[model samples]
Structure formats: C-alpha cells, structure tokens
Target: MTSKLTLSVFTAPSRPVNGPPAIPAPQGGWTWPPTAATLIAGEREAILVDTVPTVEDSRKLADWIEASGKELTTIYITHGHIDHYLGSSTLVDRFPRARLVATEAVARDIKTEAESGNDRDFYGQMFVDELCSTVIEPEVLADHRLELEGHDVIAVATGQSDVKDSSYIHVPDLSAVIVGDIAYNDVHPTLIGSDHESRLAWIQTLSQIQDLKPSIVVAAHRRSDATNNAEVLADTIAYLQKVDRFLPGNRLQCSSLSR
Candidate 1:
C-alpha cells in the first residue's frame, strides 16, 4: 500500500463580528485562534479527529482527503458535542466507506437529542447557525478496543468534560492521543452538564493521559501546538483548582450585583 495520506491541520478564518471594534486589552499576549480539524493520513486509510461546524469547512477537509488518495476509514467523534460531530454527514457523503465512530454514550446521546428535537436548536443557538444544518448519527459505537488498518484503536470513556461519553483515542504506534474537548489551552474551559464528581473525573482523565506520555495531544478546540499530554495534565489541574475555589455562592453573588 502506498502511504499517500498526510496529516494536516488547518484553522478556519475567524468569523466577522459586527459590533464596533474595541481597543485591545493591555499587556497580555494574544491567544491563538481555534483549530478546525486534525487529520491523520495513512497509506490506505485516513482518520479525522473532529469535524468543523459548517458544511463548507467539512467539505474543505473532505476535498483534501480525497485529493490525498487515501480512503477515509473513520471519523473519530470524541464526544457527543455538535462541533465535533455535526459535520460527520458531510464526510459520509464524500467517503461512502468511511465509518463514524463514537463511544456508546455518544451514540445514545445523539439519538436522545435527535428524538427530543433539541439537538439542533439548542446547539445551533449556542454554538453557530451552521451546527443546525445537519443531523448526525454514529455508525460505529465503540465500547472497547477496535483494530483498524493494523492500528490498535481504543476508545476509553473519560467521562465528563464536555459530554458524558467524552473520550480519548490512543494510537500507540504514533505515540499520539486525540483528546477532544477535554482540555483547552490558554482559554477559560467551558463547563456543561457538570457536577462535582464529573469535574474531578476530568482531572483524573488528564492525569491518565499524562501517564500515557504521548508525544502529541490534540484537543478539539485549541491550536494543535498548544498541548502535549503532560502540559494538558498540569494546566487542567490548575484550572480545576480555580473552579473549585469559585463556588456557586460566588456566582450567585456576582449575578445579584449585576441585577
């Protein structure tokens, strides 16, 4: 088999904001823009980490994958979030043989969200209008280890970062781990559907990833260069400590003052 597939990362052009531009804040360095996709190209198969939100963005990725001459074997949805999985349909259309792989919890969440009709509306309203454009269904519900193109793929349930079924994909050969939305770099982490235990779970997951000591760690929403397994573990621990100190009472007090 010819090794034609090439792993590439790209960032989407920033969305245009309509409001008057405010003066830049002083002192601190500017943060890097969020990366849209992280691709893994193989000799005969390719895998994508997360799909971008829009058809246009997904199509761009699809076109590049197609041009590379490697078949897209799977799209690894690290969780049930729209930003990571909504563009899956686009990939399906482009590569008929490609499978959508997610944890069982992620698949169940998609089904539940679809049946409730809130998956589109709620995520669309919160994230972007493009997220509402497609309906996603996972074809492969990964409960344990999966062997693909001579690669040992394991989807271990990390539990509670962005979604309940949130996970990390480990590729031992590459010494790489694709951690979706589990850690954010240089940005305030977003907490959703979280409880104290889940928050702790997120921290533990980070520690576990550090133990793996992957050469590269890919996060769903941060620049590709922003993280490695060790750095993510340290940064996430620090972030959680801060969250622990700022209690619900503090939030309530702040809300009261604003009103």
Candidate 2:
C-alpha cells in the first residue's frame, strides 16, 4: 500500500475586526484569525476537506487546488457551521466537475444556518459583502468514507463539538485525521452554545479522535504560529476544560455587576 500521499494546508489569513459595541474595542483590537482548508492529493486524484467562508477566499482556494495538478474528486465538509461551507457556491462553480459532499446531519445544518440568518447576521461585520448570496448544496455521503488515490479516508462522527453533528476525517493510510473545528491550534475554541454538559460531550468527542491515534492532526482553523500534531488535540481539550471552570463564573460575575 502507498502510504506516501501528500497533504497541504491553506489558511485564509486574518483581517482586522472591530469587536461589536457590547464587547468594546480595546487598545490594539482583535483580528479575525485565519481559517484552514486541507488537500489530500495523490498521483492522479485528490480530496479537499472543508473550505473558507468568503467568496474571495474560495476563489483563492480553487486556484490553490488547481495548482496542485491533481483531479479534485470530492470536496468534503466536516460539519455544519456556515463558515465552513459558506464559500460553497464559489467552490462548486469553480470546480464544476468536483462533487460537494458531507454527512447527512451536517448537510441539514448547512441548510438550517442558511435559512436562519444566524451566519449572515453575525458574521457580516467581519466578512461583510464577501459572503455569498446563494447556497451551494452538498450531497449526503452514502458511506462514511472518501477515496483519495484509491485509499480509504474514513470519516468518524464525533457527535458534538463547537457545534452539533460535527465529525473529523481519518486517513489511515497516512496516519492523520483532518479534524474540523472540533480542535483548534493556538486559536480559541468558540463556545457560544457551550455549557457544562455540552463541554463534557466535546471532551468525549476529543477522546474519539484520540482513540484513532493519528499523528498528523489537521485542524480546520489554525494560526501560523501553531503546529499540526496530536499535541494540539490535548491543548484544545485543556482549553475546553478551562472554559468549563472559569467561563460560567465569569459570566455570572458580569451579570451580577451589570445588575
């Protein structure tokens, strides 16, 4: 078996972002950190995992994939968050021959987010007009596996992480897993919907990934200063643990102070 498939990472580098009024802008202010997309390529074919949020970002990703010189077979979406698939229209249009596919649950969530206006209403300030006006639908995968150069790339349903119905990709031939937003490298994990109970679920999700024992863990969103390795999984687990400890108290303290 050929265990030498190549993997490349493309990050949509950060742009300046001013926190909304409630959050209040500090001295230097915040920046929207980069988003990641991965390409697992072989001699003749490839599989792309996830995508960036904006129209322009998707165009760049298309160009990057074109430069890889491998026929893009399928574009895999790991989960349902809009940002992960917002650029779908552009990608689909660009790669007309490539199929856009995801787990059934995730495909449903994409439709949910698109119709709910949650992504457009909140993320508009950061991405502005970059968000697409149309939705690019994806087909639900009949099986949890994607073939890259004829090797089986497995998709394991993690149940929940930052969002419900999240999953990570396991490439057994390469000893790697392309984890969506379940784990972060240096960047903070988003916990808006998280609480004590859901976080425990996330911890279990992390365990599911660890059980695979992958060496090269591909984080869906990452910072250049960080690394792609199993260690980041432990770090993400620790961050969620801290959130469980301090976040609630901090929220309560703020609530009390406001009152």
Candidate 3:
C-alpha cells in the first residue's frame, strides 16, 4: 500500500512588544521573533507537533487546526520547552479528543519547568501584556513511533538540543522531518538554551538527521526567507562551528554574523 502523508508549517513570527514592561525594547528596539507549531496531517486525521508560547498564538493555532477538516488525534510534543508546549493546554481544551503525547522524560521536564513557574515568570513577563499562564504536561507515550494514517513516523529522541529531552519527527515515506528547535535557518541559534558542550552534541544530532537524507526539514522557528533544504543544515552547522571557535575566546556572542 502506498502512504500519502502531507505536511504543513504554521509560524507565528515575533512581535515588537508585549507584557507590562515589553522587554526594554531590545538593542535596536526590535522584539524577539515568534515560533512554530507544525501540523502533520493525513487524509482523515492530523497530528500536531509543539505549540507557540503565548495563549493568543496557541489559540490561533487551535483555530487553524479546527478548520482543517480532519480529526485531531494527537498533539505530539517533541520537547517540553515553554515555546514548544506552552500552548498545549489551550489546544487540548479546543480539541478534547486530541491526546497530548510526549516522551516520559519530556513530560517530567514539562512538569518540572511548570513547577518552577518559568512559564509565568519568564514567558508571561516577556510576551503577553498580561501575565500569560500555562498548564497540562501531556500523556507520556511509551513508544517513539507515531502511526499517522498508517504511515510510520519514526521518532529521533535527541537528548540535548537547545534544551534537554528533545526529539524529532521523521516521516520516511515523504523524506520529511519535523525538527523542533533542533535546527534553525536564517536566524541565530539561541545561545541561551545551549552552551559549548551541548552545542557540540547538537551538531552530532544534526549529523544523524543528515544521515537520514531527508528532502525537507522543518525548523520550529525560522526566517520567512529560508527554505527547507540541506543548505539550512549547513548553515546551522557553520553557525555552531563559528560559535565553538570564537565564544570561549570571547570573539562573538548571539549577534547575527555574515551567513
């Protein structure tokens, strides 16, 4: 039997201002950019990966999914980062039948982070004008495979990429991978979530993905001009390489360099 798996990427680009203080308007008065909530849809049902940070962004994602004419069966979280799963609660409320699934480690990470109140203290203070809130840790999926309309979606559980307990969704039939914050295109990698040793490990993760020979790679956050291709992977590797070389010597930081 032939498998038909269709993919779509919905992004909420960053905004200039939010919350009470608005993050001090940045260096150039520019605000931080937005993130993505990727949708992997079959003919009859669909599975979503991750969610944006703010309630508004996530609610919009829920609306978009609701109108897609497919039953939302699963919301597969690749990781437990705030920007990745913060919107899951809103999504679950919107589509009650859609089960929120993640790795056991990821679930624990989500719970731990939620308990730390970073969702409110960090994201809430940075994004929403009012203090944004979050909830739900998602049901832990025992296995790594997702049967999306009978197509085998393999899970690549990467231990540390940007954050702990990261994973990627690989659709073999389509030669496509939904990489959640593992790789970025035409944007600076967040040095805050990753450091020297972890960045090296992330390079290896990207190498493993390269070995898959996927035709398309979806980054959780990306620039509008970037495309899903090997060039993006090369760009990410190059960025990390530069960081590895210069960061310890204090050559550069998160500033955008010539790419």
Candidate 4:
C-alpha cells in the first residue's frame, strides 16, 4: 500500500528589513513580509520546502520538525531568495543527514549569493544579532524530484515570478503546490526589478499553476492569519495584471513599487 502524505506550513512573522530612514517606516522599521516554509511528510520520512532567514527562526522551525518525529530526507529550496535559504546552515547543523538541494539555476544563484558579502552587509542589519553566521548552499537537484515514503514530489520550474529561477513543488498525491514567491496572499507582491514583460510572464506562470488544479496552494509570502488555498492563484494573477496595466514606458521607479 502507498503511504499517505501530509503537509504542514510554518509561517514566520513579519520582520524589519532595515532600510534607510527616507522610506516610510512602519512598525518602527521597514517591515518585510512574512514567509512560509512547508513540510511534506509520510509514515517515516519527510521533505522540507524552503527555510527561514534568521538562525532563531530556523531553530524554531527545526524544533517544529523535531516534534513530528519524522526523518528529514531532503531540504529543497524553491528559489534563490535570501529569506528562503539563508537559514539553511542552521537546519543542516540540526539535521546532519538531510541533503539540501535545488535546481541548477537556483543552486548557482544561491552559491553566488552565499559567497558574496553583499547579502551579509544588507540582511545583517535587518536581522541584527539573529542572522546565522554561515550559509550552506544547496546542491543541484539532479532529478528535479523528491520522494517521501514512495510518493513523488515533483519540482516545476516557472521561469520568473518576482525572481529568476523560481519554482514550485507539486505533490500530486496531496493535490498540493508550494509556490515560492510566485503567489502572494494578503501581502503585496514584490516587483522591485520586474518590468511589464516580466509581470506578464508571472501572470502566465500563475495560469499554468491553475491548470495543475492543486487543491492546496502555499504562497511563500502571506498574511500571518491567511489560509492556504487554491484561491491565491487567481488573486496573484489579478494583482500582476493590474500592475502590468500601469507599467510606464520607462522602468518603474523604486518609489512607485514600494509596498
């Protein structure tokens, strides 16, 4: 008999991004959106999708996973964003046996970001003493697939959605999809570097996700109180379409895209 699969999402609370004072500071600082990290489990083994940024947050996530009493077989990153993978080293230290993996493009991007001092100099200020000292970058996922208790968990590459090399995890058995930064719920979509063309691409990707007909959809960034459901797919597409309609001839100024 095939083992039944289960899904759980851990959402981190909104934290400060520590931007310059010129930007309107809400909640005492530039509040970054909350993020979700998912865990897919079976009878004995489990797979983790994405991770938090700060060591404190990752440790909390680790404790949550430990409570499940399941073996973590793999840690899969859906994108290259720092918020999604910076705390990987913390998890790695906790679960030494679990392998960290991502697509070739995401892996390359992560390696570059890990080696570069730029991220440390930037996010370091936001997280302050909470940031992890080391980053354990993911290796290239050779097959683009992960298995938990014999169930197939496939990774779908969705070109660009807020960032390059974006992807989502499709758990067919669970009828679920964990979209990293591809869909936003109750939180404004980040379009800092996005252009009209990229917004259109993002819309197309959202539509494709709709075609997958996932019963459950997990957005990487969402309101702390929001529920995970397929409805976010349409909402994300609509948000992108609305933004695309107002694209100016020139690149969108940072001020214009501010959340």
Best by TM-score: 4
lDDT of 4 by residue, 1-259 (tens): 4679999999888775656667665545566778789999998989999998877788999999999999998999999888899878988989999999999889988888878867777778766447776777788887888877778999887698988679999999989999989999888988777887787888888999999899999998987789889999999998887777777433455632123
Flag regions of model 4 displaced more than 4 Å: 255-259
- Candidate 2 — which residues are off by over 4 angstroms? 1-3, 248-259
Which portions of model 3 show Cα errors greater than 4 Å?
1-3, 17-28, 128-132, 249-259
Question: Which residue pairs show collisions in model 3?
Answer: 14-33, 14-34, 19-129
On residues 29-96, what C-alpha lDDT tens digit does candidate 1 reach at each position?
22223545667766667777777766567787688778878777878778776666777888888888
- Candidate 2 structure lDDT: 0.79
Q: For model 2, how does the per-residue alpha-carbon lDDT over 1-259 read when each residue is reduced to its tens digit? A: 5535888899887755545557665555556657899999888788899988877788989899998898888899999887788777787787788998888888888877767777777777655336665667688887888877568888777688888788888988879999998998888777765778788888889987888788999888798656799998899899888877876533222210010
Cα error, residue 238 of model 1, in Å, equals: 1.4
TM-score of every model versus the real structure: 0.79, 0.90, 0.88, 0.94
**lDDT tens digits, residues 1-65, model 3?**
45477888788767544423423444644455557777888888898988877667777888899
Report clash pairs, candidate 2. none
Clashes of each: 0, 0, 3, 0
Question: What would the TM-score be for candidate 1 when compared with the true structure?
Answer: 0.79
The whole-model lDDT of each prediction reads: 0.64, 0.79, 0.76, 0.85
